[model samples]
Target: MKVENLYSKSEENPMKALVFDKSGIENLKLKEIENPTLGPHDVLIRVEKSGVNPIDYFVVNYIPVKPMPHIPGAEIAGTVEKVGDHVKGINKGDKVIVYNRIFDGSCDLCLSGREMLCRNGGIMSVITNGGWSEYFAIPDKNVFKIPENMDWDLAASLPVAALTSYHAIKELEVSPNDIVVIFGASGNTGMFAVQLAKKFGAIVIAVSKKNWLKEFGADYVVGYNEVVEKVKEITEGKMANVVINSLGSSVWDKSLEVLGYNGKLALFGTLTGADVKINLSSIYSKHAKIIGTTGGSRRDLIELINLCRDCRVKVWKTYKLEEGAEALRQIMSENRDGRVMLQL
Candidate 1:
């Protein structure tokens, strides 16, 4: 068990990893560890691409799910280098997308075919070793094979952003010709929501800091300050049938403000803050409903990947694995829109 700096590529099977020996990105260091031993139901993946997400930072800095010396990478797409004895339908050289949520296969919820509700399961990188390395092992049940023609980076980007948006869209019950307003529309999940909501036949109003969101198919793009007013104008006083808010606190009130009668407010993130003062009367008066979601189910992820494969969810940006820390920083400092990724 020797710890070494990550300066150059390793020529051995034991790989290099940026490990957080303690909570905080500053504690992250490059170290070498033994190659993973495969379990009967596992597949060894040669990591090709990993998605950078804000939740990764929250987990690394605050969550106690995993002990010190943890690795933080959730979304992944790669080639299968080896499959375990019990693994089937997945094999060497198969391109695949890793489902970042792990469910207890024996749970009643899991058995009911809704494993995303498995009481015992949690996120992939939160405790288990994740994809911020040259290689990692995943349960065969958590892996989905992708077509060879698919781009690895785009496939990696699908697990969280795309799937979560798909789930939120489902939660919002978006219908054809509906008016959908998405807060943080320039964000990773928000951008995906704009695309998916549109494809679902909604006229999407994206609330973003930038106007370029129109490039991604947002029917209308407005800044945070203008969201409520603009939605009113765009819908011609109809407001919105559904409002998607991943941004918390700063925009929560506004999300509620723009909802029409029987509207749905789907919350997926609390970036600004969580707790909010609510007017109970507003809910009853407008007949609006508030719903919340974390990541999405395996079905949502698989469908998202299929969408990516069809050139629906576009690739955003990529950084080398060595610049992993920088990649996280960029997600915090640079454009919050689109999928920011790492290439191994």
Candidate 2:
């Protein structure tokens, strides 16, 4: 069946979207397509901004998108254009952010508060058409109103980087006495990890080439090569009680070396590489705990939005919808300091 036929309240008007028929940036194109189909519990959003992330880059150049031609945005913020008959409390023109993870709600994982890992769920751009369009539609439950004081750029940037960082920090149970070290401190998730760790009162040591991490609340900022010695000196040989490594295998050894006995390490992304070689004694001798986290749960999302009401996040740059491809390209390019977004 045609994509338009899936919607019961179909509109004849066409909308512009940035899409790719297959996995490759060279295949990305901007064209007119039917607006997304809205079910009884759906809400139509006129996208105001779409934040670009490494996953969107992965979706465009590597991963398989279910629908042949797919829109590649997972972090979205916008206004309600329409609300289905069954949708309540959400009205036209309300500012909102997409939850990005689609869950069945009745699955075991969903019931246990792990909707991001639901038995029958998937991330936005990969499983369905996403928000790199003029208009997008999703289940009303997956959209939440942005706090009235939040700006378009901050709201759009939170769904992925901020939420993922928040979940990882929460999982590690950071506390005031814990000495925390965050690798990739200047990247998308890394930036938020710094702030959230500080908020929890952990003494944050940020690992990055940049010295500006202190502005985001890193108690100490050091280069990649300086992590071991610096962390040792800072802790007076106590080592870090928690290490947040989103960069993966390239820094795996150091991430482990910096951990104190009985410390916990959180793992999320693998921007460097996945495969790593580690001695069993290295883990056993230290009494280390390794946590693998992905996206945040619905509750985590709610908590983050509330906590970040007065918090600051960085938005590196903004591009027009026509500049979507360039916006994605910059995400993997050098000298990137903050989130890149597409203003619709």
Candidate 3:
């Protein structure tokens, strides 16, 4: 593929990016800045779409970001604009998705294929600049070529939302005999968990207000108030064998209430709230296991891309790069339906 030198050696070029100077939505601005400088092991990408997640909202509104003026976006999808000499197997103009986890290859965690837990590394947007810009550079190993037919929005949602769900579901080891109940079924990660559990042959009970969840492979869709009763009726009082709760404290107790004996619960987010109380007797007596997971591995990402050829995230809305502030605000809106994204 033909490559374009966006950053010239003789003259520098600037690109537009959504950047925040401080921890507030009012501080976000779209300004022209010098293109990200590339290292020998890095590849420059012309971002096409960046997923707007709740974490992005928290980062801009509360979490401290590195280097004062920071770009905040973890899920990224774009075309390769330039590849450094040391970067192999990836060429310019290739469609790709960012891995979103920054890991040092030499770490013991990385060697064990658990890069998300690298002792010396953290998440992409938190430790360094992320993909809210028109042009950004990342290590060649941090990107994977997406299929030519994949939509930009779906590709962008994979790194965080989809990967987190995939990892959590994998940890639970859902099976055909298992009755899986997914809380926050309309949220980004919950939606993927519902589909994945069903894909694994489990009977999926999605807890959400949205009835359309059935279109995404949910065997039963019920409101938050109905989850426990619905699961009981469907399982003939056995309750759920696996309960995936990404809503945090708001549904923590209910999640446990619906679990059957030897049940496993997968946790990956704290959207409503984090602090919660647990009952020791309930856990020990029921033999319940609570598994907390985050991002998936590179191997898991590859598997996800293959398994999701026919699956897609329902995009709620799209905003321009300059409208990123509004996009972040929308992510936290109570009426929001699906994933929000910035389409560049």
lDDT per model vs. reference: 0.80, 0.88, 0.87
Which candidate leads in lDDT? 2
Clashing pairs in 3: none
Ranked by lDDT from best down, the candidates are 2, 3, 1
Residue 221 displacement in candidate 1 (angstroms): 0.7
Over 4 Å off, model 2: 1-11
Candidate 1 clashes: the total is 0
TM-score of 3: 0.96
Pitting candidate 1 against candidate 3, the one with the higher lDDT is 3
lDDT of 3 by residue, 174-213 (tens): 8886899999999989888888888899898999989889
Total clashing pairs for each candidate: 0, 0, 0
Model 2, 1-344: lDDT tens digits are 22223333445787889989877887788888876776778889999988789999999999877676678889999999998889999999899999999888999999999999988889988877778899888888898988877998778878998999999999999988689999999888998899999999899999998777898899999988989999999999999999999999999999999999999999999999999998889899999999999999989988988988766667788899888888988998887877788999
On the 0 to 100 scale, the lDDT of residue 288 in model 3 is 92
RMSD of each: 3.9, 1.9, 3.1
TM-score of 2: 0.96
